[model samples]
Target: MEYCDGGSVVDLMEKRGFSTLRIGEAVAIILQVLEGLTYTHNAEIPNVRLADGSFAKGRGLIHRDLKPGNIFLANVGGKQVAKIGDYGLAKAFDQAGLSGQTMTGNVVGTPYFMPRQQVVNYKYTQPDVDVWAAAACLYVMITGYSPRNLQDQDPFLAVLQNDAVPVRDRTSAIPQPLATVIDRALIDNPDIYYKSAAEFKQALFNSIS
Candidate 1:
């Protein structure tokens, strides 16, 4: 994983364009994370595959504990990339439909990027939660700041619940199409969120053209 090293998305944003690689290379790394998560969410069973597939495909639920310290950042030529790390909270979804009722565990995900349903509702699904986190992470990488509501315990949850502020509101400079893409991704609705990592990537690519 160190070979694919780059600091946390936060660090990368602070020093964007500082990498030794070109922008295309940086985009490739971001796409890498997309492809990796896509496989885990769509095909691999919970706890099956690592974000980068170091271990065997897993079963059960994957909490995906994301944090600043856990993630790494390094200079990739002239590009900086965000690498997923630390699977301490990564667990197998062993239960049947999460105890035949709730779709996920009560204690899951980081405050800044987790959806509200995960925190407030017991029936949230893993795919939706991951989508929200992915969008949030992308936001941090692009803006160089975590979309946290310091006033609340979990700002990401706040965003999910209210559905009032779009990602664009937080950063006015964001292009309309890109902002819309992220807005749909971060919301609490799985139906609207990209069905798979590939779909999400395509939408991003489509928006540019």
Candidate 2:
């Protein structure tokens, strides 16, 4: 909370367009958020339930609902940091060990971040799903626009089922490598994308380095 700011990233973007940022600065902002989530998942969080199998951390604490509004922005003295806030209403659940499922309260994340299965009432892992939302947010931040146009009734379905537009189509300013990261994150194939925030953070830093 030390880096806390009273405004959201969307507020900043609207006031000052993101299209002007160089790819390096864009990666820097994204790396900060990814690293933060990675740290939390890697920490010893108390009372978090584990998936009955595999014994690996079950997506840590699944943030059931992550959206531009729920996200908070702060500057570690002008370096932007994002935190998953409003956990007061989210439900964390045990992850699938090797491959199994469990009950969580039936609710879709915000229309923009909501993944397809969630909209259809399918059970999904907490952290895995959280990774999905993070990926979506990443797209918005770098492009100054939502990846999905939000022009449809079922935004998640369109976003999830339809192939993602080429990142170049999304933004000429986005570098191909970083855009590739966002593309993989929102892709239909899980094996092609990072399953955890930690994995995504590593890829991001790799790009920067």
Candidate 3:
């Protein structure tokens, strides 16, 4: 693993008391993350073995844990670059044969960043989970607060009840166009949410244009 001299985004936020970053800086970091996800979601690795001892030629991976803590910043080519890390919870699934729930019976990922479908059905296989989590990260970057501050409540119940306040409601300074994109990503209905990281990135870019 390459050394990240700048450390994780969570560390920076904690040290700086979660101060909001400049809009350009925030968007840049988000775009880097989205770019990384785009590769991970589309890359095809060969000769992969599954837990069932089955062999497969190619598969796309889902980074189940995608909070700020799992994202690191490093100075590369004289510029700070955000990179996804901590793949301990990553899962590989067949993108071509995406079938019914492949995971269940246990909760995964950070509560504040998890999507509604992930909480209700852990086995659900869809790239939207990461999209939603990335949106939560964006919310933190802009407002310095989690989309839902459910620290005191049961995370499962909080997500089930859809207790998060809309990003627009939390801060009026956010541009309405950007706020709309973030709000759409936070939607519980997977069908209505950003379908892929590339799609989400495009919407984000459009907001700042």
lDDT of each: 0.55, 0.60, 0.79
List TM-scores for all candidates, in order.
Answer: 0.66, 0.73, 0.89
Question: Which portions of model 2 miss their true places by more than 4 Å?
Answer: 1-3, 17-22, 42-45, 48-59, 77-79, 95-105, 120-123, 190-192
lDDT string for model 3 (1-209, tens) is 89999898878777777688766788899899999998997778675555465667765677877998898999999999999998766666563332222333667778888888777766545677888889899898888878876766787788777555787787888888989898888887544388799999999999999
Model 3 scores a C-alpha lDDT of: 0.79
Best lDDT among the predictions, by candidate number: 3
Best by TM-score: 3
lDDT of 1: 0.55
User: On residues 9-125, what C-alpha lDDT tens digit does candidate 1 reach at each position?
Assistant: 455545756322232433355566666566555444533333343445444444455544444665667765556676655444432333322234465557776666556653434
Comparison by lDDT, 1 against 3, better one:
3
How many clashing residue pairs, candidate 2?
A: 0
Candidates ranked by TM-score: 3, 2, 1
Tell me how far the alpha carbon of residue 63 in candidate 1 is from the true structure, in angstroms, after superposition.
4.6
Q: What is the lDDT of residue 73 in candidate 2?
A: 70
Q: Lowest-scoring 10 consecutive residues by lDDT in candidate 2?
A: 95-104
